[model samples]
Target: MSFDGLVTRAVTYELKNKVIGGKIQKISQPSKNDIVLSIYSLGKSYKLMISANNNEGRVSFSNEKFENPQNPPNFCMVLRKYLNQSKIIDIEQYKLDRVIIFHISSIDEMGFDVSNKLIVEIMGKYSNIILTDDNFKIIDSIKRVNNKMSSVREILPGKNYNFIKSDKFNILENFDKDIYYIDKKTPDNANPKELLYSTYLGFSPTIANELCYRAGIDTRVNWGLVSEDEKKALNKNIIKLRSKLLENDYTPTLYKENNKFKEFYSFRLRHLQYEYKKYDFISEAIEEFYKVNKSNDRLRQIKNDLERKINSHIKSTKKKITILDKNLSKENSMELYRKSGDLLAANINKISKGMNSIRVNNFYDENKEIKIIIDPLKNPWENVDNYYKRYKKLKNSISYAKKDYPNQIEYLNYLLQLLDFVERSDSINDLDDIKSELISNKIIKDSSRNKKSNKEKSKPKHYITINNSHIYVGKNSRQNDYITLKLAGKHDYFFHVRNAPGSHVILKTDNFNENDLISASYLAASNSSLSNSLKVDVDYTEKKNVNKAKGSKLGMVYYENFNTITVDLSDKPKDLYKRIQ
Candidate 1:
């Protein structure tokens, strides 16, 4: 949503410098709504990505790789026929709007030179990619809108290409005049930030707020209520911004809050209180923003699914344990059954076959009188035998329930830990590792059965301590198993959050200093769900002391000879070591 008109302008400027006169060497449609062009400019290959996806629509020079289909789609084939080996003549934006037009010159099938145009509209849900001839007649569009979809514009073959009509004035063309008009036309109750974006082209709400902030005016205040001094400041700021745009002075920046990426802008954003990650080129910033956001979105979706499944299983396991507990409670009366049977046998002489019941003293309870029911037809001996048989069965049930209860509880804890791992996963490969673990444990069905093979195992995150000792942290249970059992040396130290779900961090050296141990502990705590806790207990032990339980889940290990170290979860060490990818 931050990819507004200014971003488009910046991208156009970047492309004008990099891709103008470049040859389109190859074209690929990796997705239905996306196209990637391989261009060779100044002996360097650049991938220009154009996407029409409703959620992530934009144009940028991308470093991300996409897998293309084995057979090219019809749209890809059409683009190849018209634009293959074509030279980019010029790149321009449509009147400061979020639409970019590319002019190309290429030879036609008849061996005659021809000119064509490619238009990319970066409007949210209505974004599109259209190819037209020099005459501005539509050749083809990635998405065709007919009369049924829209009456204002029919983007089909043979239709003439035109910019969508809007009432907003272009800010770059008539800045002073437009500002004067905006000041007069804005109502008293209108928010200054909203007025700027609604009345002018190329200004997103973010940029509008930035302008108001730079002018030292409250963006939430009514535009008509702005003081004369503030009005002059606003005018000066707008003029300065216009000059920067004309001069193509773009300071592309990506903003983050609490270490999470939020948005990117074509110019510096003073209104937004966030950590800024500046980039030399706007294209690079855009690419990084989308790449990280897309990956996070993907990982989140996978994690949610896994979390839901694990929670459901946990509920079911709890229900099973509850039922077992109830049965065990009933089984606890087995001793009473045995006593009743003995009393009946002792009272056989006083009871007759015709009697339905008899009162007898309970010798086991200090001769207290109790009622004893008997099957009159079976006589006392037969009743006693049946009681003993029932008691034996209940005793066996109690024994089995007692043994199974702890195992079920442990399994439940294991699942909770797995859920924690999924929530903490940082990358797609980490999620894949967890998915594999779930499938292997029969906790979930393998949905990727149609794939040729399982993905290669993901490696653990590796780091070096300040003492130059290596520390490997597991991103998931599969990686945890690897780090603990295979990758670790016998004398190497292993650290984990005590009695909590966290990463298994292995310090891979026998000669580690106190700083190395503390650093490893901090790394373990940071990767856990309890990282927000003020203090976390981290347990460390030699790798040889930790052993996986027989038939236990992967990464479920028990250890002895471990020392507990309480660490401040917020004490993240700096320059501990560079992470090895």
Candidate 2:
């Protein structure tokens, strides 16, 4: 969205210097909404990327790699047919708007020379890449728009291309003449940010606020309230800006807040007042901005999708636990079945065939007489066999349920642990580990069933104490396993939060001091869900005391010979934690 008209002009200036006399050596459409052209000029080759993505559209010299499709799209084919091998004659902007037009010279079918125009519009959602003949007749476009899309303009083949006219004045043409128009036309109560972009062709909201800020005027005040001194300062600033633009002098900068990209432009932004990084050229700034933003978008989508699936499984697992608890409550019924079998066998000798019911059973309970039901059709022996069979069936069911109940509970806990890992993951590699674990557990199908795992495993967080003691902390289940089972020595100490989900911290030295133990315990507490608490109980033991829990998921371990440490985080050494980047 920051790719405004000024950005387009800066890019055009960049291309004019690099590729004006270059030949189109190669062309490829790496994505449906992007095209990359390889240009050879003055013994140098540059790959220029142009995109028409609705949210992220720009033109820049890119070094990023992309996977090209084997079968090109129709638009890509059309561009290759008409523009390939053509020499770039000139590059120009359309009156300071967000449009870059490239002039190309090539031979026609009959070998007659022809001149063509390649138009790139960087407007959001309406951005397009178009080709036309010398007479401005549309040849083809990357995105075709008909009347259904926009009644003002149709970008179909054979139509006379009508460049959209802007009522706003171009400030770069002649500042002396344009200054008059701006002074006379700006309304008294107009918002400075809105008025600048609406009055001038290339002035965006960012630059507008910057212009006000540089002039030492309060941006919240409307034009009518600005003092005469502030007005003169504003005029002076605009004149300087115009001169810089005319002289092709720019300081391309990328603004960041907390080390994350906030905005980028052709010139330094005064209003942002954040940590700003400088770039030699505007193209590099644009490329880096696009790459960072695109990667972030991809990461967010993947994270959301993986979390959705894991949450669904977690819900189902909880439901199963609920049902299992209900079934286990029926275990008391097994006793009733066993008691009835005993009573029937005891009264078998007193039973008769014609009797429907009998009271007897004083032997098993103080010999107190009790009533029993019998079938007249079946004999007493048959009734005894039926009671015993019922008792056996109930006992078998109870045995099976009890045996499986712990395993199911363990499985549910494992999923909850994985959800924690997913939430805390900071990189795509960490998520990949969690996904692979899910596949191995048969919770999800492996899409790349035949793919080989050649990537190196991820490492755990490493911290050292002030005394040069080494410690390792795990952020996920796989990393926990690696730290506890692989990296830890038998005599080394390990720390984890008591009866909670947390990281595994391993202290790799045998002869450790009290300070070393405190540092390791602090790490175990800080990396857990209860880090914000005033105090957290952490348990530590020798690595030999820790063993993988049976019939459970990865990272599930039981330990012995351990002692509890209440980690307050403030109790650790002042300079104890030094992380290895």
The backbone clash count of each candidate, in order, is 0, 3
**Model 1 over residues 376-409: C-alpha lDDT tens digits?**
7987678889889888988888888899988887
Q: Taking the tens digit of each residue's C-alpha lDDT, what string does model 2 give over 277-296?
A: 89999999988887886666
In terms of TM-score, the best-performing candidate is: 1
Weakest ten-residue segment in model 1 by summed lDDT: 174-183
Candidate 1 lDDT score at position 345 = 86
Best-performing candidate as measured by lDDT: 1
